[model samples]
Target: MKRNSYAIIGSGALGGLYGGMLAKAGFDVHFLLNSDYQHVSEQGLKVQSTWGDFHLPQVNAYDNAAAMPACDVTIVALKTVRNHLLPDLLPATTREGGVVLVLQNGLGVEVESAAIVGEDRVLGGCCFLCSNKVGPGHIHHMDFGRIVFGEYSRQEITPRAQTICDELNSANIDAQVSADLGAVRWRKLMWNIPFNGLSVALNASTKEIVDTPSSFALADAIIREVHQGAAACGVDVPESAIAKTMGNTVKMVPYDSSMRIDYLNGRPMELQAILGNPLAAAKASGHEMPRVEMLYQSLQFMDKAAGK
Candidate 1:
């Protein structure tokens, strides 16, 4: 595969992890770092992951979309709460046939993004990693850093997705093209809805939540609710999926979820996208999501307190 120029939108955590690795692997990578633009320009990007510590010296970091170069591929790694803000960040580079890879958290991001950019140009992806920004130019990757991307609604897989998969695999990253992107996304969402929100609501870690009986039960219940909700949306998640996800979560080194981190940092939490989308699906499918509803209400209460 020929190397391609790549643009990263919302270059934080997952963005930094994937983008930094790609840049390190010698791809012509540019990052739209709106929040850390100035800092990255002055100091470059500092990524500290289990893989190693990397300081990118020649990276193209931009705050405004207008400053970015037209690219073959664009990765949308923004938090779900910031989905509405993406149209203004596209610049001219993302239009036409350029593939927009949605490597975001939450369930309906593909739909939301396809609504803005045409469905044909949008691809769905999920990052099987835990990472966050620790400082202006530094990202702390806490766990696995695999990135899986593929076609969502389009008939043939776009060239951009194929090229990216090749580059990522060449670099020893866990990257693959799945036939069912919707199922892949819903599978990830099934784990996030309960674990992420409940961690935030109780100010607890995954391990802590799992160790406590009441919290553990709550987490299990929320998992069941999310499974039913996915079924309502036509995604069938088996009963054992929750237990498997919990096992994976337990393997990660101790770290707080992005929701809890956002809550602590006084930023707007991503409760709406993380929990709201699935709950909306459940309601639309005429399924009751009492456990998810309670968790969503709890997040709302916390958001109000945070003035988000």
Candidate 2:
């Protein structure tokens, strides 16, 4: 199959890893860098992964969307914190019928994304991976890099969706299509809700959050709350999903979550996309996730405190 043209909108860690892998596989991957535009243009993306380390010494990079050609598939790998920029970015590069896959954490993203790119063009991606950009043009990947592919406005997999997944697989991404996008988002959130919030609020790592008794129980409670919230929103995430996330956390590397890293660096964490949006949806459905709510407030306080 002919590979689709890929334009990575955000040049952060997630964007770098995914886009770098695709580009490394000989796909026509264009990286749209916010800060690392010049550096990546000159030095290319450097990916160091446990699977193997590779480098792209020359790359198709642009600083602004206005300079990019319309791509067959546009991966909006921006942190949900920067989603407000999507409308501006898409207009210049999202060709009609091109699929826009959002590779970000949290809920309510699909809805907003569909509004921007049209339902037909909006696809969703959930990345089960641990990776980060350690410096300009350099990414450090730890483990787990499978991608769950789904459509935002429909349950059935379109041929376009399958092709995109196939393309990702061609690029060495463990990509697969699912009939349910909402369940995938909520299932991923079972881990994100606890680790992301507590990783910051408690100043702990993933290992500390699950290894310690008090924090572990709180993690369980938060997971259940997220499960309940998912149900109230009409998605039945199975018990196994919760158990699986807990199990993975127990054995995975002792890593700092993106939120914790952001907090420590004094950059704004994605408090809204990961926690606040879900909480709002649950509250609207009359489901009160008390423990998750507390974590939300604490993160919010820290976010506010970090401000001048």
Q: Work out the TM-score per prediction.
A: 0.94, 0.97
- In candidate 2, stretches whose alpha carbon ends up further than 4 angstroms from where it belongs are none
Weakest lDDT window of 10 consecutive positions for candidate 2: 108-117
Off by over 4 Å in 1: 155-160
Candidate with top TM-score is: 2
Task: Give lDDT per model, in order.
Answer: 0.80, 0.87
Tens digits of per-residue lDDT, candidate 2, 110-215, equal: 6667888787788887888888778988999998888897998898888988888888887888899988998889988898999989999999999998999999
Candidate whose lDDT is highest = 2
